[model samples]
Target: MSAPDVVFVTGNANKLKEVKMILASESSKINLINEPLDLEEIQDVDLQSIALAKCKQASKLLGPGRPVFVEDTALCFDSFNGLPGAYIKWFVKSMGLAGIVQMLSGFENKGAEAITTLTYTDGEGHFHTFQGVTHGTIVTSRGPTDFGWDSIFQPDESHGQTYAEMDKAAKNAISHRGRAFAEFKAFIATEFK
Candidate 1:
């Protein structure tokens, strides 16, 4: 049987590409794509809640009978006690890469976690949330990639290489977005089987 058509709503082209790759690697029956829909993203401390709210809002905006999904990624720092939990996007934008390093300079414990939350809708408005998390520590910003806050964050399983330092394949193998997409792909495969 053919899987349900999935529309991913996101503004990040890098993320969209990565999601396509992850889903494509999972099964042959699924089609992956995205639509640029400007939906209100509520400022919530919880990544899941934010993604879910966006999913619901997108469903209402796009009307019914469209299986759409929204993804939200955040980098939460333990030192700040989640001060920038879901607001990591804003933080990165306002602070820049060097500023992030400065933000952690005073704290002895620079632990952080990368979180990716995905909310899927079954066209009629049913929402399913899938999450992925990678524990790591904040390092001095490095690498040439322009994607988000990747330069400063190093995953525990990355062998000391930051996300920006790794290629697409390496990053996908252990990234929060990748893990979340992994679950998302599995869910689609089973549900549509």
Candidate 2:
């Protein structure tokens, strides 16, 4: 097998797929093991800490000798003073994208930001951290191709299109995950390759 020092641990399949795709070209020399790590989710006020917690859990589950990576993203709307930053997932499920749009319809300001924090741990227990942020605005209307909250959230100066409106390749090129994983890939290249 290729260099067996890389493992991506996540339970979100869609997120995992996108991440693997992003890393594929850069990680050809390494064995990219994809596995869902079982970890209990706890209440936290920040994305960095949550990602680290997940990474730690995965490393421990992997028996102290396997490297694992984890990522968590939070959507912060300036209009809401980042009300749903760390609680994005919960809010999305409870309020849905449409509800969020409706809730923000009256506000003149639609500014927002998406933040992703990534945490990685080598089998030796050494850790690495990275973060990426994309600033945007909340659109009053949903887009046709957008999934999740992408339909209702528009990036700043994005030439007028929601993330869901962009093609996968285009979205990947400028997404929060993409930005963060770019740093992550670089880290792996420098450290593992």
RMSD of each: 1.4, 1.9
- Residue 192 error for model 1, in Å? 1.4
Q: Give the Å error, residue 63, model 2.
A: 1.4
Task: List model 1 lDDT by residue over 1-193, tens digit each.
Answer: 5555678888788777778777776546556667888888897887888998999988888789988899888888899887688888788889887888789898999999899999998897578999999999899877864888888988999999899998888999899999998898888877676
TM-score of each: 0.94, 0.91
Clashes of each: 0, 1
Off by over 4 Å in 1: 1-3
The clash number for model 2 is 1
Which stretches of model 2 miss by more than 4 angstroms?
Answer: 144-146
> What lDDT is obtained when candidate 2 is compared to the true structure?
0.79
